[model samples]
Target: MVADKSPKAGVQSVERTFELLEIIASVGGSAALGVLAEHSDLPLPTIHRLLRTLSAMGYVRQLPNKHYALGPKLIRLGESAARLIGSWSQQHLRELVERTGESANMAVMDSDMAVYVAQVPSPHSMRMFTEVGRRVHLHSTGVGKALLMQLPNDAISALVSRTGLPAATENTLTTPDALLRDIDLSRGRGYAVDEGEQEIGVRCFAVPVPDAPTLTAISISGPAARVTLKSATKVAPLLKRIAREVASEFDEHAAG
Candidate 1:
């Protein structure tokens, strides 16, 4: 087949291919060709052609059930991207730690969970420690809530239903309605709090990174004694500012 030489056509083809890949990822990393066609609003022949090209390039694979899954080759790309983003945000997270006197973290939503990508610990001995790459439930962590609050209510309901809202601690929200209420409160207040929700005696405050390319959040956490409600009130503005700065830098890098 002759390749289309028109620039506009080439760009559209690239966009459609990526849109198909995103659809597969959004549907749990695997989907039937018909499903991809329906979701992408593209014809079956076009979907099949794109998937064939992607599979030939080792960017996607055919599953035993005849569905297509993201290929192993993409893992390296994802890890590298995560590391770059984490590196870019480290200074901001360190500044957050200095301002809040707590462990500062950056996380992005992965599948149905919030995955920590970077962190900077507080100076105090009794600081919080959420290891990078740790995945937490959306209803039990400040960063999780911050990311979740960006989703529509119906999407949140579907995710809560899929994950079943299992309790991580006594304070964890175990129902969709309760979690939704908290999400609303977080949106209204411009930040989210995990007050002994993920772990007893620990508290966390988080704000979503403004205009982030992905569903990213930044947070500060520590022993409940130190990250008190009053302290969170004082730190929220700082966290938001850092989030904005990080987002700006990220956008600039992506553009460049």
Candidate 2:
């Protein structure tokens, strides 16, 4: 690929190659070469060449059906990112599950949604289930509100205006006024709560993700019956403590 620096700078090959990886990542880890080429607007030969290099580098994998997917190398890289927050979340999450006897998760805001970055399950066969990498609306999740608390009130209001609190369940807070009130409460108290707003019969309590620099949000969720006020009262303090620890560890790592 020759540089077109004589006049208008053309697209860089390395940049386009990473963009193709992003396209694959956007499509939930996998996509066909044709789709990637079309989506990236790169020539088919160029895409094939890039895929070959990426595959060799262990950043991408080629399927038997000729599709390409993000490879384990990305997982290793993400695990490194997670370690940047201290690998203790796994230990803390398990302890939380044992204490509450319900499923728990830690997630971070990915754009306008929250993505489950880590999870630990209760010993029960029937418990709340949230897969890693799952995306949920920021307006309807504890992690969402926790992350929102990081931004200023005016900024949050603007985001709500843009995203619009589309109703997930009838119980969901769709009005801007209601959500703003809830955000204020979450900020004042240091944790966010979901009462069957996202899913009926599912209650969640989320503490503000500490450390604005890492942009991490942490949360715990389970059945409403088990995660009710009485149970939450028991768990809230612990959740806040762990969230602070995670944030503090990340901050220390960054400082070091």
Candidate 3:
């Protein structure tokens, strides 16, 4: 028989293409050819070939400054993907809202910030409300911190340096050291909290969606008067459990 050419041969190339795309995204959506080579640990020639193909496919663009950036075509795909995630998240948010008597929200990382994609408002008139599509800093909000929890310390530091950790309230962590400490505590507790950081009188509890298709988080927010420290202890476990369920359902749907 002649030399065989299996689809497996193509799979490796496809995987490499996606890997390069991820590397570009990881480095803030733009990378010089040398930077790409260094980060990917792939040969310059391989990077060039893959980037060329991606450029032709309109998934990557070569900048005037000789860096490669995520192309405009990706925005459409990303928006569509976010919409799907938001749709799937609605029922989970509803459950959290019903059980916790607070507004339940789902957010995903976007443009280096966490943006709300779905929300189920509380029945009570006094509940907190963060509109869907509102972008909040990763250092100043419960859902934002939860979204960042899984990233490496180096990545988190880099993100903070880029975003500058602007304070939204007196309680917001404005230093990397403080934010890291808070992240450590959040990790230990298996949840994150926003105590008047995003909004005065509002307290939020959030958990990262484990094994999610994207960096995603879900949260419940209410008046700080109603959502006390004692109640946070009770709400955190439920937030974590529901987050896992949301991730499971999302991953199942993605695989199918």
Candidate 4:
């Protein structure tokens, strides 16, 4: 018998390399060769060769435990990608602000927190504003809940265990059970709400960006006086629509 090699072997090799990288990222950015091979369904020798090439290119590193991990070079690439994603979503956020008469925000899940990536403030004088790059606990904010609810229940449990649900305001959910209930509600209703949870008298409505390459959400927030529960009913649809638009933009960019 002769070993068979396909014409598209080079393309397959490239795809397998990216699959390994994605597996490492999914496993918190580090895993042993056996683990990578198990997840990738590729031969151990092939995985080793790819890892060696990736390591030489500074895209992966061998840790003390002999596990391959995402390398520091990925940090620069990730930051640049994040910035571009944020920039691309700004117009959609601005549209959200215009439609809802509230501040609109885009956020992505980073570890155990939700990091604000972009914002478009309401034209009103009394609008809400969260600084770009501000990281907030995932258990309390609207965007946080929106991103969290997209994960599996076990992953959600693990994350909540790591980052305990601390009270951001008196109305914040301070227990895992309560937060989980809210997550369920968000998943059921197609959106999440922060009713004075992150800040007293501030309300927010958030929807996850569907089909996004990463865990991302878009939200609209303002004072309770203006952004009431009724306002949430009105804004949720807009948020969801805009989120889908943002996700489509992401898909297009990824394809390009």
Candidate 5:
């Protein structure tokens, strides 16, 4: 399908505003309003008005130097969008939650941590706890391992050097060699399993979110009583299928 053309009615203002944001992003961070106006081919008055409106809406930020950049609202909006698309994984996560009665989540690597972009909560009284922006170390979580498998050995080594294998729990991998071995095993198995690594008694089964430019992963998690090796064996294929579907959705969205 053809993508929607920009500057639709009533959103011409938004289009112009994003145009300025594009200019700033193109400049590799921030830009003066005059340069933005020139780049967007809009009049100074119009650019100022659109920018003012965007700033008020929190989509554009004004730096101390009077330059404009994308704001926190962009992250908020992107998260909202991620959730919408993440709903594709919801059917699977919900099923996993229902079958295992545990919390299920889909996360992506953002710098050094795994951020929960989407989640399906268990209805049980004792459930795994997590939120959208919840970030956890790469070496300590199942979702992190799933995503880390996508990186090359050299890159993984670099990340290990940068983050250091800090143990979240006694069960957590505290050495680069151990973590590397786990990553390799996860890649070989086409899934990653966390056994009381991130938290005591919490187990997770994870698969990589495919078709992304960078690493992204999703997992179903719960207490060890419910999310055992046998349970993960049952859920692995399902999680991989859902992750692939979500990845395709993301690919299409990015292409559009």
Candidate 6:
């Protein structure tokens, strides 16, 4: 109980509590207590006590089958964090739009989907339109592939098995093998390309935000006629540069 009153003890307890929550999240956001005990450094009793406290606080919930998952309260926190990150990245996305002459957007993986967090539309009359907060499948968008590239093949396979790679357009890669191969190609080129996968006559190019807080990606998208192969080759560098600036902005935000 001294841990509740001592500053140092309280800090350690908070750290351990968050570490356990992260472990639960890392294993897909639900796990048995024994599974958590195996992954954590804390003893079983400490883990149990922390979980009990968290459950009571509504930050973690125990299922009928005895597994624990992140609770609804964390959803409110996650949504607020996403909005903050989105606001911080907007200026960089605007720079990307200016440099590339295309719409620029930022997305982060939310659960099994990629959700657009920020966007700066192209000045041109014909441009891609992705509303902020719109969730899209991981196999059908440029940001999706860039986000998925952060994960291992096995993790992606497990995810694809669950989501089943629903096709958005004829260009969409609907099979796990195809999506993996495309991601591999994207890795070679250091970016992902939509090539009209999300919508006909639209093309998108995306690169992951390095050292980002989450599986985050920034992209430039526009009509395929305007975003041709030669244009895409040139715009990729600008996207990457903007991504670096965005990462620096996030660092500053965290430090402050």
Error of 1 at 239 (Å): 1.0
Supply every candidate's count of residue pairs whose N, Cα or C atoms clash at under 3 angstroms: 0, 0, 0, 0, 0, 0
lDDT of each: 0.89, 0.78, 0.89, 0.88, 0.79, 0.89
Clash pairs, model 1 backbone: none
List where candidate 5 sits over 4 angstroms from the true fold.
1-81, 251-256
lDDT, model 2, position 211: 58
Q: Which residue pairs in candidate 5 collide? A: none
Whose lDDT is higher: candidate 5's or candidate 6's? 6
TM-score of each: 0.91, 0.66, 0.92, 0.86, 0.68, 0.92
User: For candidate 2, what is the TM-score?
Assistant: 0.66
lDDT of 2 by residue, 1-256 (tens): 9756774465688888889988886554689977897788888998988889999999999889888988878867765675444355788788788788887788775545677778887788767788877888887988788877787778777777667888888889998889889999988887889888888888888887565454567777877877887776778898988787777666666667
Q: What is the lDDT for 87 in model 2?
A: 52
Model 6, residue 53: distance off in Å is 1.5
Candidate 2 off by > 4 Å: 1-88
Pick the winner on TM-score between candidates 1 and 4. Answer: 1
Off by over 4 Å in 4: 1-10
Estimate the lDDT of model 2: 0.78
Q: In model 3, what is the error at residue 39, expressed in angstroms?
A: 2.9
Model 5 has an lDDT value of 0.79
Clashing residue pairs found in predicted model 6: none
Question: What's model 1's lDDT at 168?
Answer: 85
Model 4, global lDDT: 0.88
Better of 1 and 5 by lDDT: 1
Model 6 scores worst on lDDT over the 10 consecutive residues at 1-10
